[model samples]
Target: MTTPMNNKNSLLVELFVEELPPKALKKLGDAFANEIFGTLRKLDYLEAASAKTTFASPRRLGVHITHVREVCPDIAVRTRLLPLQVAFGPDGEPSPSLLKRLEKEGATLAQTTRAFEQDKEFVFLEKVAAGRSLRDGLEAALHVAIENLPIPKVMSYQLESGCELPGWSSVSFVRPAHGLVALHGDTVVPIEALGLQAGRETHGHRFEAAVDPVVLRDANSYALQLQDEGAVIASFEARRAEIARQLAAAAVKVGGGSVPIHDDALLDEVTALVERPNVLVCSFEREFLEVPQECLILTMKANQKYFPLLDAQARLTNKFLVVSNISPDDASAVIEGNERVVRPRLADAKFFFDQDRRKSLASRVESLGKVVYHNKLGTQGERVQRVMHIARGIAEKLGDAKVAAQATQAAQLAKADLVTDMVGEFPELQGTMGRYYALHDGLDAAVADAIEDHYKPRFAGDELPRNNVGLVVALADKLETLVGMFGIGNLPTGDRDPFALRRHALGVIRMLIEKDLALGLDALLQDAAAQFSAIAGFDSSKATVELRDFILDRLAGSLREQGASAQEVDAVLAPFPQRLGEVPKLLAAVRAFAALPAAAALAAANKRIGNILKKAPEADAHVSELLLKEPAEKALHAAMAEVVPAANAQFDAGDYTASLQTLAALREPVDAFFDGVMVNAEQADLRLNRLGLLMSLHAAMNRVAQLERLAV
Candidate 1:
């Protein structure tokens, strides 16, 4: 090891471990680096212009921070003592408590009395405390960062006892750690963790390293040194980018415009699995291609972690790419080994597909009884029956008898693929395989397509269901889940949503709005709840209202994600617009109306009107012709007679923006009425009349949205 630099230098810390879980490597790396940076900065070791670079590989997580001070400067500290009143008495003598406190702090009465000042309410003392050593700070920081890692699961292992006959002691971490390296500038920081003392020694790739303990010379040279001598790409993102590059180049070599499957998650996993990435092309027999490409691709990716290459048309080619940890002089053995490993996986996929096809989805329906959807909600078979009934109702509302029958049939068969062997192995292929089997069983093409598409819009920004049958079934399926789950009090809380109710809610919202379905939201939910009416203690009324609220909350979140501001979303969604398809138009009207010169004043005036109406006696919003004694009231009344009709006509035609703009004419009259008229006159008739006029105005202004919510 080299001697330490005197002043500013880079800082490096590494935890070398056994192979880490690929799924959590990125999060673990980010958390570790941030924790170390935060700790060092708190200790005043980091400069303002310093930068932190993180490195992570299959075997290690490390960070190199520049501009860290070798030693923190001395800091001035003020210690608060007793209050002046308690430290001194009116007789101008030190209190006994003050004497004891000063003695406990190793301060004399004369010095403590000098610390008291008339300007300060509390007596204070000052001292210059020596700064912490880098070794001490790093020890605490390493302990905290390791303990705080966001590890999915931790393992307990036996570490050999120091200076003994290989006696074992237990330790717990994400993985069994073997080495730690903490260097400041050119010297070791003398930190210890994970039952090991810090050093400049860390091993590289298991096979391809030029050095065993890849001796890191200094903090700033860690990355380059690893690459040069150890043959390991130490940066996770850099290695991932390299893999992506090689995968692309290998795809081009296939010569058919083919490319590897574009999956960021798969790319990250592959990066975490290898220290040195060597991309190789391999192939299997084309006969395995007879199986669905989804099945083959899923097996290749999920089981073997291989990326299947696809042609320009998005069809899977027999060729695929593997990311190997070793790069040998000749890669023929590695390529052959990977290819051989993947063939059996693909063959297992084909065998499952073939065996599943022997029985139609219709015959597998009886087997679903064994699958429990939820303990409280009964079996999947029971839920399927409920979905089928709700789908028929929704279909009948959307189309004729034939359409309704087709929808029920699709819903009946949607969950049938859950029992298939291919889907059993790959649960993500549920709806996809159902569509294929439906076609094989000679079902109508519409029914087959519906089986596949009912689970569309699976996530945010995903596509909606394709056809009318799909719309009906998707709506029915999602509504059944929402109603049943909410009925059983399986509501989602802050973080836990075991059933993915949010995704289902968003799916329902996307289908309704994207398809522009004319089905009424409340009516659909009520009908869904009524199907479970026979179940003991089911309340259709309460469930409908709760389900509507739950879905509306999801709608607000979805609308905000689509670029609607909070005010715009609140204005449109506050009333729980059951005709959600019309919400876009309402928001557009609100946005356009907000931009007009008269919007703010009108919004304020509407807010004033709402406040006035809420406090007044209960009265119908009807103005008696005889009670319009004030000129402002009569003028506002005449204006409303002209504008309300035209605005109502526009609103009826779905010209929401035009309707709101027409109400802009009310801003002047509204301002005059509020400023010139007292809505609460002593005369009861006059007060009622004014309240009525204000109520009518409030109703018209909020037809498109709660315009008052836009008020500053």
Candidate 2:
């Protein structure tokens, strides 16, 4: 250790441990570095322009920080003591209580002063507190950083027999830490953590390091030294980029426009597993290509962490790429070893695929009765029956008998694959395997496609179903989940949606709005709820209402995400439009109408008319031509006669944009009516007629959306 100084210098810290979980390494590395940096900054040990670079590897987590201070500046503090009356006697002299407090605090009466706190006087002590040195500050920061790491699960182990606490030798951490390094400039900071003392040495690349213990000269030389002597890439991002570059180059060397399957999650996990990456090309027997590319690709990527190459037509090739942690003079042995390891995995996939086809999906439907889907919602067989009924109803509403029959068949076989061997080995291939098996059974191509696509739009931005049969089945499947879950009162609260109810609701909304389905949302939900009526004491009314609100909420959010303004969304959605498929048209019409020159005045008048009609609850939209008394009312009635008819016709024809624009023509006459006429007239007949006329104008202006919601 060197003598303490106040000069700014770079800092380096490392925690060497056993292999961390590959999936969680990135998050763990970031959290560890950020926690330390935040604590130091809060303690005033960081300069204004301090920066941090994170390092994560299979065996270590480290950080390099710039412009860190060795010691913080002393701070001035004013501490509140007892009340004035309690701190002193009536003689106006120092009391025994005040003397004891001052002595304990290492202060005298000279440092005491009076201050008012909440209308009561109290004695305050003014003093300057000493700042923390780098060694002390770093120790505290390390303890805090370790305590806050987002470890998926922790392991507890007994430390060596000679730890700091003799007989109390248990140490618990994400992994048992072996070494701790803390450096400031050229000096060791002398901090300790996890039963280890700070040092200027760290090991690198367990198998390929040029030096067993790489000695550090200073904080800035850490990365270069580790690379030159240790044969490791310390930075996570740099290593991932290098791996990606190598993968692309190797793919090109195959000379068939081949490219590695791109997956960020796979890349991240592979990066976490390797300290020094070496990409090599390998191949398997051509006979395995008979299996679906999805099964083969998933097996290679999920089990072996390999990248399956795709040909120019985006078909999986027999060859794949492997990222090995070691590199030797002859890479043939490494390549051959990877090929040997992957062949058995591919064989297993092929075996499962071949065995699953021996029995038809229809024959396996009864097995679903024994497999429980949810305790309250019965088994998989029961759920399939519900989905089949819902799908047939939706198809019938679409007015195509052939489509209704195909959808019913598709829904019946959809959940049958849940009991298949292929799906049991890999749960992600549930719907995918169903489609292949359906095709094998000589089902219609449309029905086969629907068997796979009922689970489409599985996540945000995912594609919708491919055909009409698929769309009908998808809608039925999602509605079954929403109605069943909400009816059982298993609602999502805050951020904990264990059942993925939010995603299901969004899927239903997307199908209705994007596919332009003509079914009313209320009726579809009612049909879904009816399937649950056989259960004892089930109430479909409350669940239907709540489920409708949930779907509408999801629709409003989806519209906003698609670039609709909040005010526009509110205007269209406030009326609770049951035909969700018409929302986009209504929103478009509202947007177009809002852009007109007379739109502002008309919207303001509509809002005023609504408020007036609210007070006169007896008002109706029946206007009487014989009872027009004022010129403004007569002029408004005349404008309605010419424009309202065209607007009503355009609206009925589904030309919503033209209809709203046609209503814009009433703005001039409507403004004159509101400015000159009193809707609440003295005579009962005149007041009722005037209210009726205003009500008619209000009705004509707000057919597409609630124009008053757009009012500023």
lDDT per residue, candidate 1, 86-156, as tens digits? 87899968889888887787776655434545676776655667888889888888888998999999999
Query: How does model 2 score by TM-score?
Result: 0.91
lDDT for each candidate structure: 0.87, 0.91
TM-score of each: 0.93, 0.91
lDDT of 2 at 252: 99
Candidate 2 residue runs with Cα over 4 Å from true position: 1-8, 81-126, 165-168, 595-601, 668-675
CA RMSD per model (angstroms): 3.4, 3.7
lDDT for 111 (candidate 2): 93
Error of 1 at 376 (Å): 3.4
